[model samples]
Target: MVGVPVVLGVRRSAPVPVPGAPDAGAALVDGYGRVHRDLRISLTDRCSLRCTYCMPEQGNEWLARSSILTTDEIVRVAEVAAAAGITTFRLTGGEPLLRADIADVVSRLARITGPGGPVQVAMTTNGIRLPDLLPGLIAAGLARLNISIDTLDRDRFHRLTRRDRLDEVRAGIAAAAASGLRPLKLNAVAMRGINDDELCDLVDYAVTHDAELRFIEQMPLDAGHTWDRDAMVTREEILATLAGRWDLTPVPGRHGAPAERFLLDGGPATVGVIASVTAPFCGDCDRLRLTADGQLRNCLFSTSEYDLLPTLRGTDSRTVDAVLRACVRGKLPGHAINDPSFLQPARGMNAIGG
Candidate 1:
């Protein structure tokens, strides 16, 4: 509630009609000159666990099944993106595992080709069902994985997620490692009084499981709109906590990666911190998000969304591509979380892609 609250309604921005669509082979470049190649697609807005930092415990309306893009429609969008310049596709969601046909979706997206080559397909999941679904996903061409785990204590996990599924999550993490997935990552949102103390422990757990851990500074994307910046932990504090145990050496040339990686004690084992609040990386952002309901989001904190469901259902691929270009062209220079005039989006992280 830091910014002025806007009345909640349909925040979708009507797709603008352009004189003509940009070249089909043109890259997805915003006005700021950043060529976007990474696309985060939200398969569904429904999740298994109600994480306190993501959504509320109850009374939240879910996206209608009919409103969500079907498998065919999703493939159509990916095809358009692939034809353009998008080379990386990261499937996100309230919980992407909730999608019954997730393997099918991955198999189809893996076949897409971008300017680089065959587009890389990855996913960020809660990892509750990974134990049962990792094999199918791997066979379907999931190149990488990122699992969310904020705490190691079972009671703390239950309190944060409002679900008793830490064992299942751990099992899922194990399953990912067993599958021989390279660079398996664990994402933990750093909260001051919540999981801040467990920074080293989480890194240790990641090192033990042969997975890299990233500490993400909690942003203002909760469904309840009650995010307090003062309560959120910063990147300096996270590094300080870990530096108390090991010497964290900075890894240079991160490029467009969200996490600023550091070598723990100058070894193969490493840790990362995504300081979205204190240290914004919007200047080099090369990513775009498409919601399950077929809206293209330029930024994570975007107040406006470009509706693509109508274009997908009514027009040809060129028209859809035009909408996509327009969406990127409308991107703001940065997410002004530090600016007093900034306003939180009407939709939360679950509604947006994570």
Candidate 2:
């Protein structure tokens, strides 16, 4: 409401129980009994940097402006989602900072409340423009942030992202920490023969920056769709690499979180590994995705997407809630990336809202 054109004061409407809809007070539950509370919203598919693992260096087609969701439409869907028990919202994108109205979007959604109370808002970004946007975003109620920093080396950073902006990214990270966003997390995709050897160095860097480093296994979400399972760095290998330098103690229970965390040297500093490829956490997955084009995805690797734009624009709140509920009910048990019949999604990570 702070930066949006629409008027505030819209009341939270009650759920209209259509056939197959969840009971009035039920959260977004799937057949596997996973209650969906986290929603990842992609503000845009256009990015400033073209990471080799995400998209091509050039010639990537973006969504048409008319097809993308407006600020009003996004807030409306968030309201419906809040009513349906979504408690946490994460804004993602090819680069979420690419949108000029990002702070407005954050300010508006931060006001939405679900069963769990004031909804928590987070974001995943490449951090190129975070320094410029951090002040407004923090003032607008951005709860946390996850920045992608695959490699700390200047040349390797350039090779991985097709950009020589590592200094900008590092400055952004420092700025965020100085602003009191503590326990800040930095995401690094572990690619074999790429950044695998720098595991310990990355952790050291995190320690120096007062940030927690998370190493994610590269899944088949690339534009080329040529992901080879054999080439991806695994959780075991990552831990093993770190074991050479520090005594890692697995930091107990994971409550539906994708990352497996560990305390470095059995003390304060920590590191995490998101083994999405080798050790799948689909059973505990409570997240859903909303693309910039207004499509709802039950899973990151889901082959099917439920469109919410038409219902959002042409129908009432009840219909939009019904669509949201239906999408959750239709979630697959897992991504099934290891299955022989698995097929890569038609869109790349940039389009899919990583």
**Best-matching candidate per TM-score:** 1
lDDT of 1 at 109: 98
Lowest-scoring 10 consecutive residues by lDDT in candidate 2?
3-12
- Report the number of the highest-lDDT candidate: 1
User: What digit string (tens of lDDT, one per residue) describes model 1 on residues 145-192?
Assistant: 999999999999999999999999999999998889998999999988
Q: Determine which window of 10 residues in candidate 1 has minimal summed lDDT.
A: 5-14
RMSD values, in order shown: 5.7, 8.9
Model 2, residue 62: C-alpha shift (Å): 0.7
Distance from true location, Cα of 167 in model 1, Å: 0.4
lDDT of 2 by residue, 116-220 (tens): 789988999988888888999999999999988989899999998898999999998888878888558999999998888888888888788888999999989
Clashing pairs in 1: none
